[model samples]
Target: MSAGANWAGSHTYSAPAFVEPTSVDELQQIVASTDHVRALGSRHSFNDLADTPGTLIGTSKLPHSVEVIDEDTIAVAPWMKYGEIASALKPLGLALHNLASLPHISVAGAIATGTHGSGDRNSNLANAVAGLTFITADGSIRELQPVDDEFDGAVVSIGALGVLTSVSLDVEPAFEVRQDLWEGLSWDALLANLDTVTAAAYSVSVFTTWVGESAGTVWLKQTVPGRVRGELFDATRAAVDLHPLPEIDASPTTQQRGVPGLWSDRLPHFRMEFTPSNGEEIQTEYLVPRVNAVAALTAVRSLADRIEPLLLISELRTMQADSLWLSGAYDTDCLNIHFTWKRMPAEVAAILPTIEELLLPLGARPHWGKWFAAGHASLKPLYPRFDDFRALALEWDPTGKFRNEYLARTLDLS
Candidate 1:
C-alpha cells in the first residue's frame, strides 16, 4: 500500500508515508483504508501542500487514458503529464489554452495549484476543466460539472476536498506558435511599452534580475494559423538585439528555433537544452491584479538594490480572469511576479516579508505550491472565496482524511 518512504524535498514535513496506486480500484482501496491521504504528482511543489505525515498517494502510476469524448472535450487521467496530453490531442487538432512553467508537472497537480502561463487573454490551466472526477474521502467517486456550484471551488481544491481521479478538459483547435525572444531592453522602456509589447503576441513574458533596472530577456509566443509559415520577429534584425542564449550559455540559433508541439507541451519557460547557472535556488511567486502589474513591478524594481545580489531571476507574466474560486485570476486579470533566489535561504526568507509588504496593497495572491511565510490570516484577505472553499472542503471531506498541516494552516481545513 505504501510507495515513497520519505518526504520529497518539500519546504516542510520531510518524512511521510507515500503510496502509488496503479488503478482506480486500488486508489479507492487505499483511500478506504487510510484515514489520512493526499495525492502527490511530480513533487514539483515547493511548499508542503502535497506532504502528508500519514499517507501521500502518488498518482504518477495511475492508469493513463486519453479519450476524445467529442470535438470540444477530452477526458484524461489526473496523472497525465501536460506533454503527454498535448501529444495525444495534437492529432485531434486540440490543445490546452495555457500551461505552467514546466510541462513535467502532472495535469491534476497543475490544476490543483492554479498553475498559469503568460497571456493577458489566457487563464490558468484549471479554468479549462469542463468537469472532473474525484474520489471523496468516503471512497465514493463523484463527477463534477461546471454548472455545479462546487465546480468552481473544486477546480482549485488543492487536494483538500478529495483525490482528483480524472479530468475532462475543454479544448481549443491546435495552432502553431512562433516564439520571438528579445533582449537588451531597459526597464523604463519595457514598463512604458509593456502593454504594446504584451499585446503584440498571444503570450508574453519578460525575465530579468533584481541586479540592474533592465530586462534580461523577453519571450513572446504568438499563435499563427496553418503551420506558422513566416518568421514573427527576427533576432538578427532587431535594432538592439541581446540574445537570451549567451546569458544562459545556450545556442542562440537553437533558442530561436520554433519547436513543433502544443503550447502546453513547451510550458517550461526555460529551454532544457541550456545549462542554467548553478546555485541553491528558492522560488516565490505572487499574483496581483493586472492593473497593478506595473506598480508592483515598479515597487519590486525599487528593491533591486536589496534583492539583486542574492537573486537569480525575476519573471513577469500575465493571466486572464477565471471562475475557479481559489484561482489567482479569480474575478480579474492577473500578473504573476516570480523571484528565484541564489542560495541564501535566510536572506530570501528575510526579503519575503518586504515583498509581501509591497504586494499587499495590490491584492497579491501567493502561489499555493510555492514557499511563502504568510499564513491564513494574510491569505484570507487575498482570496475572497478562501472561507467558501474551506466550507466546501468540510462538506466534501468531513472525515478530514485528506487534511494536512498545510491545508489546515492555509485553507483552515480541519
Candidate 2:
C-alpha cells in the first residue's frame, strides 16, 4: 500500500503495473492479452473494490468525447468526469436527472458502483445510462440499450463485467436549481416528519454530528419553480453559506441562499473546481429500503459515542427505486446513509460490524466503493437478482479475467 493506494490511501492495489490505452482498439487488445485485469477509474474508491492482483487498465487515458445524439440522449467517454459531462451538456441546454454529491467522479466508474445523488424522486447515477459500449473479456465490443434483457445487470457491474468504454445517458432540457441550508433539527422531529423533510426540496440532504438528538444541518437543492422550504420543524435557514462538514470553508460548496442556477451547477453539493470532502477521510455508506430508514438511522445514532471519535460527518439522502439488478435501491426506494470518518481505519473497521449488525437486519447493503465489512454470503439475499447477476458475470467473463479479490470475497466467486 506504500504505492498505488486509493484516494483515501486506505487500500493499496496489488496491481503489478498499470496501462493507459488511448483508444478502444488498444483497450480491447490489453484485455484480450491479459489473463486477469481490472478497469481503474479515478481512484476515488476507498476500498479494494477497484484493486486487482493483475494489471490495472486505467480508464482515464482511453480517449475522451461527448456526443449529443438527440435531444434526449448524450454519449460520453468512460474517463470523462461528471463535471465535464455536465459542462458539455450545459451548452446544448441539456442535463441528466441527478448527480452524485461530488462532480469529480468518472461517469463509468460512478455508474458501475451505483453512485447516487439526493432526491426523494431521483434515481441513482446509472439510471440515466440508456446504452453502454464495453470491451468484453475476449476483446469483443458489445453495445446494450435499456431495451435489452442484459441491460439491467450491466449498469451496476462494480467493474465486474468488463472495461466500460462509453456510456449513453438519457438527458433532458436544462433546468435551474437553488440551494438553501437549514440548521438545528431535532432528531425526533425529523424522524417523525421524515416524509415532509425529504419532500422539502427537489434534492435534500440531512447532515448530523451524532452528538445530540439534533441533526446539525439540512441542505436543500431545489429545482426552478420548485418550492423552497427553508424552515423545517425546528430548523432555520442559514444566514450565511454553510459547509456540510463542520469547521470547513464553504467556498468549495455550490452556491447557497436559494440563488437559482443551472442544474449542473447546483445538484451536487461540492463545486467541481475544488476537491470534495477533506480527501483525508474514509467513507462508508449503506443503502437500506426507505421503509426502514428511520430505524436504520436510529440504530447507527445509537452508537454515537463510537462514531463521533472517528467521524468527520454523516449524511442522509434518499433515492427513488429502479429495476437495475445490482442497485441498492432496486425495486424499492432507498436512503443512502453515509459516514465520512477520520483516517482511523482500524477503529472504523472495528465499529462497522456493530453498525452492520443493526442495519443489515434492516436490509442495509453497503456502497460498493466505500469501506464495508459485509461480504457476499451476508449480502446476497438482499438483492433478489444476485445469482442472476453472478450468472451474467460468468457469461461475459468466462475465464474470470475481470474477477478481482473484492469480487471473489464479496460475490462468492472462486
Candidate 3:
C-alpha cells in the first residue's frame, strides 16, 4: 500500500492496497474486492475527499480520448487534463466556455468539486457537462443526461456516488482570446467597473495584495475576431507583461509552448505562474451573490488595514449560476474572492473567521475543495438542494463503500 498527499499538503491517508487501474474492468475488480474504495485523480484536492482507508485507485493511467460527436459537442474521458482537452479541441475549432485557473486538474476531479474560472457570463466547469458515464457501486456503467432528474445531483458528486469514467461536454467553435493585464486602480474603481470590465472581455480577474492599495495587475481576456492585429491590444499586452500582478510571472515554457502553463496544471487557487515570496502560503476563496460583489469587496477592502501586510495576493472574479448540486454557483450568480496569506497558517486562521463574518451577510458560499470554516450545517442554506443531493448519494452508494471522514463531515453522509 502507498500513501499520497494532496496539493495543499493538508491531508494524507494510508491504503492497504494502492492500485493504478488502466481499464474500467480493473477498477471494478478492485472496488468489488475491497471493503473501502476511492478513486483518486491528480491528488489536487486540498481536502480529504480522495483519502480512503482501504484501497486507493489512481485513475492517472486511465485512457483519455476526445471524440467530436458533432460541431457543438465532444466526448472526453474523466482522466483527461483540461489543457490536453483544450489542445485537442483547438484543431477542431472548438473551445470550452470556461476553464479553471489551472488546466492540469482532471475532468472528474474538477467536476466532482465544481471548479470554475472568472467571468460574470461564464458558468462552473460542470455546467458545461451535458452527460456523464460512471461505474455505479453495483459495477454497472451508466450514462446520464441533462433530462434525467438525477442529472443535477450527479454532476458534482464529490466522488461519493461512484467512479466517473467519462463525460460529454457542450462546446463552441474555437475562438481567439486576447489577455490584457493592467493595474493601479482603487478598490472602489474596480468594484464600480467590474461589470463593465468583465463584459468587455470574455473573462476578467483582478489581482491585488490584501494589504495597502491595489497593485497594478488586473488581468482581462477578451474574445477577438480571428487573430488580433493591432497596436492597442499589443500595448495592453505590453503593460501586462511589464507590471504583472505581484505573483504571476509571464514566462514561456517548452512544455506548454511558452504560454503560462502553471494556470492549467496546478490547484485551482494555486494556478498563477508568478512566483511570490517563498514564505508559507495558504488560500481561502469565497463565492457570494453577484449583485453583492461590489458591496462585499468594499467590506473586505475596508478591513485592509488588518489584512494587507499579512497577505500575499487577493483575487476578484465572477461566474454565472449553474445547476450542478453542491456547486458554489448553484442557483446564483457568483462573485469569487480569493486570498493568499504569507506562510502564516495561525495568522490566516485567526483572520479567516473575521473575513467570513463580513461576507456571510452577503450569502457567501465557500469553495468545497478549498480551505474554509463552514461545515454541513452552513452548507445547507447555501445549497437549497442539499438534501436532494444526499438522497441521490444514498441511492448510488447505499453500502457506504465510498464514504470517508471528509465526505461524512462535509456531506453529513452517515
How high is the CA lDDT of each candidate model? 0.75, 0.89, 0.73
TM-score of each: 0.90, 0.98, 0.87
**Residue 306 in model 3: shift from native, Å?**
3.8
lDDT by residue (1-414, candidate 1, tens digit) is 444322223254443577677889999998878888888876667777877768888777789999988988999998887768877887778878877655667889888999988888988888889999998988988999999978999999888878888899998887767666666567777778777666656777777885564566777676764233233222222333233323554342223444444464344554334333232467789999988888998888878889887777777888998878899889989889988766577888898999899997798899988778788888898888888998898888888888888887887776
* lDDT digits (tens) for residues 1-414 of candidate 3: 576666556556666678898887888787777778888877666657787767888888877799988887899988887878877886676788878776667888989888888777789898989899988877778899999989989998888888887799999866555555555655555655667655655566777775555433556665554233232221133333422226445452112111332223311322334322232456678998888888888888778888887877777788898778788888899889987666566787788779888887788988777777777886677788999998998998898888887777877986
Model 2: ten consecutive residues of lowest lDDT: 1-10
Worst 10 residues of 1 by lDDT: 228-237
lDDT of 1 at 210: 50
When sorted by lDDT, best at the front, the candidate numbers are: 2, 1, 3
- Maximum-TM-score candidate: 2
TM-score of 3: 0.87
Model 2 residue 21 lDDT score: 76
